[model samples]
Target: MIIIDAGHGGVDPGANGHGVTEKDWTLEVSLHQYHFLRKLGIQCKVTRDRDVLLTPERRAALVKQSGAKVCISNHYNAGGGSGAEVIQSIYSKSKLAKQAADALMAAGMPVRRVFSRKGTAGDYYYMHRLTGSVETIIVEYGFLDSAIDMKKLSIRSFRLQLAEEAALAAVKYSRGVENSLYVVQSGAYYAKDKAEKLCEELKQKGYEAFVRRMN
Candidate 1:
């Protein structure tokens, strides 16, 4: 299982830009990721499903309690800087964090860097500090303050792409693949109607079966 933190909620709106609030976007993306992963048979838990503020300590406690092996704290940057960044704990090096960041870059958000917390030994970020054994990383999707970034974020399709990429990365971190295919062929029909019939029947039986159109 994995823990996903939709950082900054309630009174904490996080970074704001182009009339969009970080809290709202974070929750939107996080929940999208949650459902996507769940559909792929990967268990996931979100810190806050709704617009409610959660202290870093409390969020960390939730991750610990969830017995999750990996965690991601989602946020948006506020500074004038543009592009995305993935930050790992000062205490550990995480290839999983890098993978997620790269996935985000592929989806659209240009990666500024994959880095760890600087200054002081041990955990620099509170959420990173308290996650215990869970390999946690902070994903700043893009600089909300940057006009270029905000313009991209304003697109609904872009946001959906970001959510989908995050879900793909999480699955990679846990299961080392986006999906484990389990194909169950119920029937084959040259007629499109018969194939659609079997597809609906499989869907009713709780199996995600589909028909393939071949040339």
Candidate 2:
């Protein structure tokens, strides 16, 4: 099983810029990843599903309790950086982090780096140090303070795409499958009419298309 931790919530708003709040954006991405993983037949759990506060200690405890082998703590960066980054636990290798960085890069998000930080005690982040045996990864989707990042992250479609890609990376890492099969999806829409319209357009362009409802 994999655990998805949406960083910051409630009173802790995290980073905020360009009309986007870190807590809300992280939750949205985490929820999308959770559902996408489930659809792929992968067991998954999320730390918080709504606008609620969860301390670092509490979030780490939940990840350990879940017995999930992998925990993804999602956050939007702030500190003037313009690219995505994946921080792996110092104890873990860079495999998963590299995969995540690659996915973000493929989606046109610049990747700052895939590396681990260390504190005087041990792992730099609480999510890694306190999460017991779970392999915890801190993913900074992009810097919320940067206009370049917000330009893409502000779009619902782009955020959903990132969620799916992150989920896929987790699935690949946990399953140890180098050649996993992936489905090509054009888009995900909330409105049935919008989806059907896309389907019709695809069909008209000499492609086989259908609108499948998501439960």
Which residue pairs in model 1 clash with each other? none
Please list the Cα RMSD from the true structure of every candidate, rounded to 1 decimal place. 5.1, 5.5
**Local distance difference test, candidate 2:** 0.87
Candidate 1: worst-modelled 10 consecutive residues by lDDT = 175-184
Show model 2 residue runs off by greater than 4 Å.
184-215
lDDT of each: 0.81, 0.87
User: Model 2: per-residue lDDT, tens digit, 1-215?
Assistant: 99999999999999998878999999999998887777555799999999999888888899999989898889999978888989999989788888888888888888998889899989989988999999888999998899898898888888888877877888788889786546667889999999989988987997656565654
Best by TM-score: 2
For model 1, residues 105-202, the per-residue Cα lDDT tens digits are 87878988888876564777877777788888888888888998888887767876876676667667777664433435779889999999988897
